[model samples]
Every structure is written in C-alpha cells, then in structure tokens.
Target: MKSDMAQEEDEPSGAVLDQPQEISFRRALLDRISPLISSTYTLRPFPSKWQVIRHKLEQLRSYLAAAGDSPSDSQLMELLQSVTYTAAEAQALASRCADESYTGGKLLLRSNLDVVSAKLDFHLKRLEEFYAAGILTLARAIVVSRPPAGASREDMRFYVKDLVSRVKIGDSQLRLRALGALNEALLEDEKYARILSMEVANGVASLVTLLESESRDVQEEAARAVDSVARFDSHKAALVTAGAVAPLIRLLEKPGTSMEAKERAARALKKLTENSDNAWSVSAHGGVPTLLSICSEESGTSELVHAACGVLRSLSGVEEIKRYMVEKGAVVVFVKLAGAREEAAQVQGIELLLRVACDDEQSTAVREGVLRALVRVLDTGSPKAKEMALRAIENLCAASPSVAMLDHLVVSGFLDRALLLLRGGEVCVQEAVLKAVSRLGGMSEVVKKAMGDSGFIPELVRLLEVRSLQVREMAAETLAGMISVHKNRKRFVKEEENLNRLLRLLNPEEKSATKKFLVAALVILTDSTSVRRRIAASGYINHLEKLAETDVTDAKKVIKKLSSANRFRSLLTGIWNS
Candidate 1:
C-alpha cells in the first residue's frame, strides 16, 4: 500500500497524495492546533489564514526542537509560504532569526531537530552574508560619492570642515587627495561652494598655503580648488585676504611651472578680479606685469593665453591698470592674440585691446597692426567680438590724439563694414556702428561723403523709432553728423518717415543730449524749403520754441534757424490761419 501511494504521488494530477503521508499528516495535525496557538496569545486579530499559518509555523518549530534535527529547505519554504506576513510580522520574524538560541522545543515532528537547526543556520548565514555584502558596497559608494542633491546647509558645512581639515594636515600625498576631493565637492553645487566660502574658518587661507607647496601635484590641485571656490563673489575677498595674489602671480611667473598650474592660477585670478576692489588688489601685487608676460610669452599654452587675456581684460577696466598694461607693451601682445587661432584667445584679446584703447594716452601706443586686428575682428569675429571691436574703433576714432588711426580706419573699408553692421546687426551692434560712423563722419568730409553714399541716412532714420533710447540717440547724432554735407541733408529731407520720427522726439521725455542731436539734425534738414514746410505743418516749431526756454543751447539755436527761414514762417502762418 505504501509503494502504491508513493507511485500515486509521482503522478501529475495526484494532488491528494502530492506529499509523503507523514508530512501531510503532520501538516493536518498543525492545522488542527492553529486556533489553540492563536488563543494562547493576546493581540489584535490577524487574517484567519495568517493566524493559522503563524500557529502552524510555531508548532512546526516546537516539533523540530523536540526532535533535535533540521527540516529540508523545501519543507521550510513550503510552510512559510502558507500566508503572507505584514511588515510588522516580518520585523518580528527578522528579530527572532537574529537570536542564536531559537531552537524548537516540546512539539512532535516527522523530521529530526538537528537537521532543522543546520538548515536554518545555512539559510541565516546566507542572509547575513548578503546583508553584510550590501552594507560594505554601500559604504564604498558613499566614500567616493558627491554630496546628495539639495544637501542641507549643516551637511555642507560638515563636509567643508572635514575636507578643509584633511587639506590642512597629513602627508603631501594625502593632502593632495583631500584637495582633489574638496574640489570635486565644491564643483558639485554652487550652494556647497557658498558654504565652503562662508562657513569654514581659515578655509581659503589653508588652500592658499598649499599654492606654495613644492609638490607640483599639490599646487595644481590647490589652484583648482581655489578656482572653484573663487567663483562666488563673496569668497574672492577671503582669497585675497589669504595672500593668494602673490603666490598666484609667482605661479604665472615661475618658468618651471606646468602649463596646467599656470592656466588654473590665471583663471583664479580672473575670478578674483570680478570685484572691482579685488582688481586693484591684483594690480597692486604686480599682477599686471605677470599677466602681460603670460600674454607675450611665445611658448605659452592656448589656455594660458586665453586666461591671461581674460584677467588683463578685467584689469584694463581700471584706469591705473590700463596705464600699467600700456606701459608694459600689453597692446602689442593683445593685438597678436586677437588674431590667434583659438577663438577664446581671440575674443578675450580683442576685449582687452578695446579697454586699453579707450585711454587717450594709449592711442599713440596702438599701431597699424592693432588697427588691422580690429578690422579683422569686426569683419569675421563673433557678434560680441564685433561689438567690442567696433567700440575700440570708435574710441580710437573719437580720441583727439588718434587722428592717424582714424585715417587708417576710413581708408581700409572700415566705414563700409560699419554701415553693413548697422543695417543688419543686433541693437547693440547697431549702437556701436552708429558711434563709429559718428566718429568717422567727423574725421573728414571725404569719409562723411563715403558714409552718406553707403545708404546710411535711411538706416539712421529707421533707428530713430527703435525701442532702445541709446540707439535712437546715437542714430540722431550720426545723422546730425552726416547732414552737415548737402547730399545727406537732401537724403534726410526726402524721408517723410524720418521727419515724423524726429517730430516725435520733441516730446518732453526725450533726454537733453538726444533732443540736442535731433534739433541739430532737423536744423540741417530744414535747409530744404519743402522739409521746412513739413516741419512747420507738424507743429514741431512750437515744440522747439517751448524747448528753447530750457537750458538746451541747441534748442535755442534750432528755434533761431526755424524762425529765420521764410518758408517755415509762411507754412506756420498758413497752418495758424487754417
């Protein structure tokens, strides 16, 4: 009969005899004892089947302990699978599994308790191994990880203190590693950078000390860290206070320094100079000569050239630094870099050149090569480069001391390019081009004729209605400059739109200088009798008469010119009669 039952159990559909008779009989006995197990405990009710399953598991455990052997893996899994446990139940089971004395006792079972204990031990060991492996992997990941996103301020402060302490002590190798980590942390978020800048006491000074280290690796990493931290304007003062300027300059001047260190130091200096006060500080520490040397160095790397140009550009905004750079022959070096193959070097070099060229004392220092570079930048450079180049050209042309440079620009198709940019460029470009045209127009009648013939009059008339007040004012000034020539006056009078746009500027809200230019342009345009009649009919004569009461001398002059013109008086008399 037992052999027959075993054969039945092997059949696919034999659910009734799927397990050995002893195991099935044991489960049936537990099923009967399940309610008794639940009644013995005082707690809230569990699901009906869950109560029975828990009781059965408990009874099984007791039976295993009484027998002193371990159950098979499949048997244990099958018993536990009878019902799902809640989170609370799982926690309780985990706690129970953690106990080393959890041996079954005082219950009957088919299997030996010793086998059950060994099997449980094997499964528990596997679980503990997995848990430990996960923990170790997580720790390794955290050790190398950047701060979590949106890390709290306290967390950032702690991170800064830890890294700063590490950077302050230990062997050179360890400190270098710490600085690398610190730089990584600072670059991870702008918030963390701010925390490092403000929270950690003497943090910046510590990094500054590392800038003078004998180890190149240490110096480079320290520079990179300062560069990252210096991005925030608030920290720049701290860096300067820490005496970083002299060491950074030394890095730039040191012949043996690697290109990477030089480049990073230059960039850090550039960031520090974002504040105007820090800029003067950099110059005071002899940074100008160092930076100019970097720019002039033939063997300098492209990055070093670019960064040095950037720092010089910032410093050039200060009048004292401008004179210093010019005295050190920075103009010639900048002119060379403005034409470099690297676009960053070209852009920054051009900007630096522009700032230097703004001073009248530097005009004689600017050579023909520099003019050609400005023309080249204006012709093919980026929009920003073009804007800056046009500004430099305007400054050169407008400076009383740079008449020779102005003549060179006019003869080299510079005015023609200015007209093109004025026609199709952005508003800023248009403003710059107008300033250049105005300056070049004043240079000589030949250039004025060239500007008038470039169809510049109509473009200037269109700009009068542009939204930007500066463009409108510059356009007015440029037109006034051109209208001194008879042909430009005729052209200005021919555009009724231009006449009306000028009439609109008679509103009291227009600035005094803009009003002056508009009035000057109108006075010249009214030399034509027809335009005078149109201006009179537009009632702008009355507007000009009212403006004459103000401190505007040009307004008074325009009133005198309009009143002296017979055609304008007749048109006004006719309009008054009508």
Candidate 2:
C-alpha cells in the first residue's frame, strides 16, 4: 500500500494516474513505435526505384530523415502508422507518389495514418530483396534517357554526389554494373552526357579514380569506360581538357593494364587526336616518350607495341606530331618490333611503320631504321607480320623512304617465310599469307624467280584443298592476282602438278568455296590451251549450277567477281556441259 501511494504521488502535478489496464495498452503501443526509428536502416543505399514505387520509397526516406530519429519509439510508431497505407499499399504505390488520396474506411483514426504506414513498410514483399538490383538495372536504363518525372538533371547531380559518397564498388560485377550504367547514361542522356563529356566528364573522372582499384575487373571496366568515352566526340575534348592523358599514360605503367586495355587505349588516342589540339596536348605532356617506350617492348605480346605504334602513327599524321614522333626516335622502336616474336607485335609494328613512313606523299624523307624494320618483318616475321609487312613494303617500294626495302624483301629469303606460313600454320595465317603473296606478286621479282626455282606451282594448287572457306578463297584469289600481273609468277604456278591440284578443288567432295576458287583458278589458267582443255575435261559444271542456288553460302567473294573475270563464263560453260 505504501509503494502504491508513492507511485500515485509520483504522477504529474494535478494529473490523476490512469488505471493499469489503460497504462499497459499505452506501454504496448510505445513498444510497437520503438521499431519505427529502427526501420530507417532499410532505407540506405537507396533501393532501385520502379516506375511508381520510387516515390513511395522517396516519401518514406524523406519522412524518416526529416524526423532525424530523435522521437520516442511510441511516437515514431505513431508517425509511421499515420501514413494511412499498408506497406503493400505504400510499396505498390505507383510512380505517382505525389497523389495522397485513399479510398478506404478501414483506415486508422484520421490522425494515426502515418504511424501505421511506417510500421507496415517493414513487412514488404519477398520481391523487395531484389529491389536494389532491379533499381540498379532500371537506373542504368533510365539514365541513358531521363524519365519524364520527378528526377531532374539537377536531382541526378545531387543523387550522383550522394551515391559517390556512399557506394564503394567491391567486385567485378558491381564494377561492370556501374560501368554499364554510366555508359548507357553517357549514350542516351544529353545532360549526363554533357556532365561527362563537357561539364566535368563525371563518369570518366570516376572511372579514372577507380583505375587504382585492386580488382582487375574494376581496372578493366575503368579502361573500357575510358575507351568508350573516347568514342564520343564531345567527351574526347573533355577527357583531354580534364587532363586525362597523364592518368591514362600512368595506367599503362601499371602491370595490371591488360593487352585489351592497351589496344583500346591506343584506339582512344586515335579518337582523342581527331582534334588537333588534343594531339598537341599529348605530345606536350610527354606522351611521345611513353609511346616510344611501349613500342620498344620486343619480348612480350606485340599487340601492345603495335597499339602504341598505331597511336604514334595516328598522332604523327599531323606535321607537328610527325616532328614529335621523329624527334622521339620512334623509327628505331618500329624496326625493333619487326623482329619480335608475337604475331600481333609484328603486324601492328609494321602497320605503324606504314602510317609514319611518309612514303605515300613525296614531302618527307624515309627513316631507314623504319624501312629496315619493315623489310625485316617481311623477311623474318610471322605470317601476320609478313602480311602487314607486305602492305608496308608495297608502300615503301612506291616511294623515297627505302625503295630498296622492297628489293631486299623479294630477293632475300622473305618469300620462304610466307611459304612456311602456308605450309604449317593455322588457316587464318595461311589466308593472310596468301593475300600477302597476292599483294606483293608484282613486287617480288625474285619471288617469281623462286616460284620457278622452288617448284611452287604444285604447292599453291594443293592449298585449294584447305578446309577453311577463307583459306581456299584466298588461295584462289592469290593465284588470280599473281597470274594477272606477273607472267613469270603465273607460268611457274599453273604447270602440270598445279593444274591437277586446282582441278580437284572443283571435285564433288569439296566445299562450294572450293568450287568458287576453282572457277577463279580456272579462269586465271585458261590462257594456256592445254590447261583450258584439261579443266573442260574435269566434270564440275553440274556442281557449279547447284552451288549457285544456295542462300546461306559464304562464297560472296567469288560470286561477285565471276561476272567480271573474262574466262569465268567459259569455265562455267565447261562445268555445265560436263
């Protein structure tokens, strides 16, 4: 009785103590509201917004943050419940979050609506767990093109700041997601595009910062993003303006940048210099030295060197840029790459040499170092390198910068390297080697001589049996090109052994491409009376008719040329009758 009297005396002045039953309900109610403040934890990182549900979430987050978590639990629960909607009702609330009308009589006392709604948001649908992932995808989609609602460019700017402040990319997938979103946004939205391409290049800047990410995936994404941004004309200027060159150069020094990234970076440099000022910025910023060093790496994959070479070649196309490349002694590295082992290395290095060789225009003198390199690549390089070298040698042979390089290529053992490629390597290498042989057929006096000397006609004909469509077509095309321009090369390759091999390519068992190549080879060899009759003796006419009817065929290279070749029609006549 004394304790009860003390509790009664402890009541607020002039207020009567309520009965225990009434006080118990009040306490229970407060217990429910205690969770209202705790519920705010769910709002962080901002779940992706669906078209309509985003507003409800926004409203919920706004209310929670607006209250500052300082209220009592019971009061909080009351406020939450006062929202006048079930969690389902709220989460399902359409994109029209601004509309607050309700149609229910089961509502709480008019004053208790918010409190009830806040409490209900906690028990949302099972699908809610994937809400963030969904919203992330939607954000990526919508960012490309802005939605027609509440979020504005200004709003996105603020949201971006908030996101950047909060999100820490933890893995490759997340990095991919972020990069994808930014790429879409850059592609679609004028505002975000401007922000990235002009205002600040925000996405590009963010990716650049992530260049240091320990995750290879993140670095890869970052590098790819840089390349993508470089594709946009608007962004290229921004990247250059934002001092992106040095950071990109610095990234190259990191052992982490993949060959793919190096290739892309080289491509980006090409786009970046589409504006001359950017090229000036690159050279002025020590980019020349970096390109030279990257090009000098003769031991690893040559793609890196080729990529670096492509960049220098593209950059130096401008007079000032050419002077920068020359002063940097890029030719020495170009020659070095010709002797490298990796196929891409040789191919790219020769390509770069062609770009800067100044052989096309009569203005500048040739760098013998560069010429020697092309000659070396032509003579000693792998199949791809030799193919590229042939193109470069063609250019060199046409002009001032080491016209002698061509002579060295033909007279030396260079022709043998190509033959080796055809004899043993993969079909693609063979195709490329065949094309190189065609391209240089007119240039290789000794190669023509060697064809006679080495009895190459039989070998050339045998290649018609190559399984790859591309290889067979290339072989046929090579024969036609060689015979069209060089009588010596033609005479040496169309003799007895060669004629029989070419005839078999039109055999019923061969691919349609083989038939097409046979047609081409037959046309080239038809100038000789005996070979012409021998081809007529071969029964291929019925097969050619059947092949012409196929819709899904890949012999487009041959079909288009058939009408133009003088002997193609007669060869068709022979095949049709036989």
Candidate 3:
C-alpha cells in the first residue's frame, strides 16, 4: 500500500469527491492521526496537548463512522481536508517533541504544541456545526424504516434522528415517507415527540417548511406530523416557534388544496393555538378570515368545518383576534353553522357564536337566520350546545336592546324552547336559559305576559331553591321583571308555594344578592290588598324588617308598603268594631 503522504498527494485539491472517494479519504486521515495520538511524547507540554487533540480526533472518528453513507458535499469535503492537514502538522510536532536532545527550545516546542491543539479544537467545533446545521447527513432516496419492536432508548433515538435527517435533506418522495414515519412514531409513543422537540432546527422547522410543499401529499403528511407533535403541550411551543401557523393558514386559504390537507392543517392549528401565546400568529397571518371562510363553505367536510371552528374558538380567546374575526363576518358564518343539520356543526357554531355574539348585532340587520337557527339549536342541540346557544341569544338581546328582535325570537318560538330548557335542562343550560328569559322579560310587558302565560312564573319560583346561587339570582331577576304584569303577579301568588319559596330566599340569614330582586317583586305584589295581607302574615316578615335596617336594595320599600297596608287595615277594623 502507498504511504499516507503519497495517498494525500495523489488526491486533487479542492475537488468534490464521490461518496466512495470521500469515505476512503476520511478513513485514510483517521488512520494517519491514530498512531500520532497513541505514541507517547516525552516532553511535558507535548503529552497533555496530544491528549486533548486525541480526545477531539476520537470524537470526530466516531461521528463519521456512525454517520454511515451520508453523502458528501463541497463544504464537508473541505472540512475533512482541513482535518487531514491538521493531523499531518500534529504528527510533525509529535516527532519533534519526542526528541529530548533537539536544539529547539522548550518555549518554541510548547508554542507549536499550542498551535496544533488550537487547530484541532477548531476542526472539532466545525464538525459540530455541520451536525447542528443539519447537513451532516443527506439521506439516499430509499425510504426510512421505523425502529424495531422493543428497541432500546438509544436505538429508538437513532431511528428518530435518521428519519429527521431524511426529512431535512431528502427528495420529495423520501420526505413524504419520512414525514409519515415521523407521524406514526410520534403517535405510537410520546417519547418520540419529546425527542423531536429537542431537535430544534432539524425537527419542527423542517416539518414547517413542508407545510408549503407543492405536493399535497407531502404537505398533508407534514401537517399530520405536526398535528401529532402538537398534541403534546411540550411540543406545541416548538411548533409555533418554528413558524407553523402561516403556512397552515395558507393551506386553508389556498383554493386548490384538498379537503384532507385543509383538515390536517386546521387540526394542527387547533392544537397549536390551544396555547394562547401562539394565538397571535394566526391573527398575524390573516388566519381569522381564512378560518371563517372555511366555516362558511356549504360543501366543506364536517371534519374540516369542525376543525376550523375549533381553531377559531381558540383564536377567539385572544381579544384582538376575536375582534378581527368579527370584522370578517365570523358571526354570520357561525350562525349559519348553528343551523346546519349536523348536530356537531351546530354545537361548534353555537360555541363560536357565543364568543362573538356581542359584535354580531352589528350585522344582525342582514342576518335574518340567527334567531331561527338559535331556536333550532336550543331544541335539538346537546346540553352544552343548548347552554351556549341560550347564552348567545341573551348576548344578542342585550346587544341590540330591541323589542322587535325579542318579538321575532318569541315568534320563532324562542320562549317555549327556553322554558323547556329552564325546567329540564342541565344546571348550566338552565342558567343560560334563565339569562335569556330574564333579558326578554325585561324587554316589554307583552313578553312578560307571554312568558307567564307559558307557565314560566312557577318554574322561576321553583328555581329559587336550586343549588346554584347564580341560577337563583337569575330566576329572581326574571320573575321580578315579569311581576310588573298583573297576570304574571297573579300567576306568581296563585301558588302559595311560590310566595313561600320567595320569602324563604329573602330570609335575613340569606347572604345572596337574590334578595334584591325578591324585594322588588314583593313590592310589586303589594299592588294587591290580599297579596299584601298574605305577605304581612308570612313568618318571614321579620326577615324583611331586619333587611330594611341594613338598607338592602328595595328592602326598605318592601317594609314601607307592608307597614302602610297594615295601618290602613287596623284603622278600618277598629272603626267597624266601634
């Protein structure tokens, strides 16, 4: 075999080597450096310096050996050449340091040793740079395989790193395969996701770039991988920081994108934005309008629409983005979704509508379908859906402050649906319906009469004893609003049970704000002399007398009304007896 120096001279300088040639050159260089580091040097500084250089060279050798079949480019070839040259210099220095009788002084020999050590350190750092830069390995066109069953942690780590390397540098076909593998791995074990997250540059960033791939398959696979990784809260910030939002939004806004791709992209976004800090990226990239458009599409797949709505729901938690979505007609889109035949779509629509309902009134002039859709949702939606739907209706009523809207809702049968939910719905749903009923009750005497005639008064009284303090307060307020109508008042007093429930809630021991509304209702009930006598005769009158001393809302007024009626009744009785 030719000597190492002759082999080095035979190779052309600054030329890109084929894979075999590069491998041979690296092997030869490693062979030449090994004996130099292994041989002992007698001098003091030389021994320690060779030890440091030996450690660095050993690390480089292991890196190259393990990085099997990684294709070489000009930059890597140049780095290898520099390492080879530095190894030669180290050998020469080693030979001189071994000769104790040499005329070269200790200072000169030590300085040379220092120079050689520094050069080796620089080369090692460059090797690390190549690794971190994600160009250390350019995978062949062959597909990457997943780790074997029951693989060791280090083995699994190697498999993930190999796949990530392929994703970073492989062709379109290889990248798609690698992304699919990565998605599978991440889903199969969360440990793989944690590993990927640790690879900041070669990992999430490579996947984010694939989001804009010209091929839909590649883009979809990339999005699916991102979706899997994003499922882990620890991985979400990595994805967001890698700039995943803008390209995903592009997929949603892009016209020719497949429904599958859009759904994957939307799902990824939904997971990513679950962290509120990542929400601004969506708004910053015009994602609000794109998401709204997806929701508005009549032909969008249910999954696509649902995922888009989910992202919108997360974005709405950010106040600025919520306003932007409203500006882009998100309310109308969601309102239409609320009316969709699919219960899932209706639920999502109602949820998003609840977020933007206050701003929805601005467009209600053109939204003739909102009330009917909401009423439909209230009728057939799940309990949570019904709660959101009712709350949305209450928001609309409060926003517009219009009697015509309330009349239209009543005409569309809102009152009946609300009463049905109030009587039998879940506690959350009951609270929401009570809010809507309270808003409608305060609107006009006609609404109050309609509500009372629908038998809402008894239900409101029964709710006074519910476990939820908020529900009791809402019920009292609604009953108070309706009690101004004579028929509603009569409906309230017609059941002695109703008066007792109200008075029990108004007891001095009660600490809730519901007493204010109860006092107001009783003050109205004083309009009837018989009702007044019944209230004065109830055992809870002393509770009101104590409440009046504290000056609770309208508590003093209730006391004055009862006291005046009693004085008048006493005088009449005395006159008749005399």
Leading candidate by lDDT: 3
Across 111-216, the per-residue lDDT of candidate 2 in tens digits comes to 2335434344552221132233331121221122234445665455433332321123223454466565555554555566555554331445666677666766
Per-model TM against the reference:
0.54, 0.48, 0.66
Quote the lDDT for 330 in model 2.
67
Using TM-score, give the best candidate's number: 3
Any idea what lDDT model 2 has? 0.53
Write the residue-wise lDDT of candidate 1 on 1-578 in tens digits: 56853554444531333234434543554454444334324323233333333333342333322221222233333332332122224334323333423446313211233333344444334423422333101111113234588876645655565566456533576677678888888787877677666655567888899888999999999989888878888778778888988899888888778788889999999888877777887888888888888887779888888778778877887888788888888878888777676667777787777677756565453655567789988777777778878777766566543456656766777877887887788888888788777877787777788787778888887877778889988988888888899877777777677788787778766554577788877767766668766876886676777788876677777666667786656788999999
* Ranking according to lDDT, highest score first: 3, 1, 2
**Candidate 3 C-alpha lDDT tens digits along 1-578:** 99864555566754455778777877787678656646533445456666666555554554454345666566777778888888887777767766653457878877877787788778767766776675565434433357777877655665676676566555677677777777888889988998778732246788889889888899889888888888888888888878888999998888888888888899989988888888888888988888888889887899998898888899988777887787788767888888787879888887777667655434565333566777888877877778778777777677776777777777888888888888888988888888878776777777888998788987888888889999989888988899999887777788887887788777777588888888988888887888878877888888888998897757888788888988988899999999
For candidate 3, the per-residue lDDT at 78 reads 75
Candidate 1's C-alpha lDDT?
Answer: 0.67
Q: Which ten residues in a row have the lowest lDDT in candidate 3?
A: 135-144
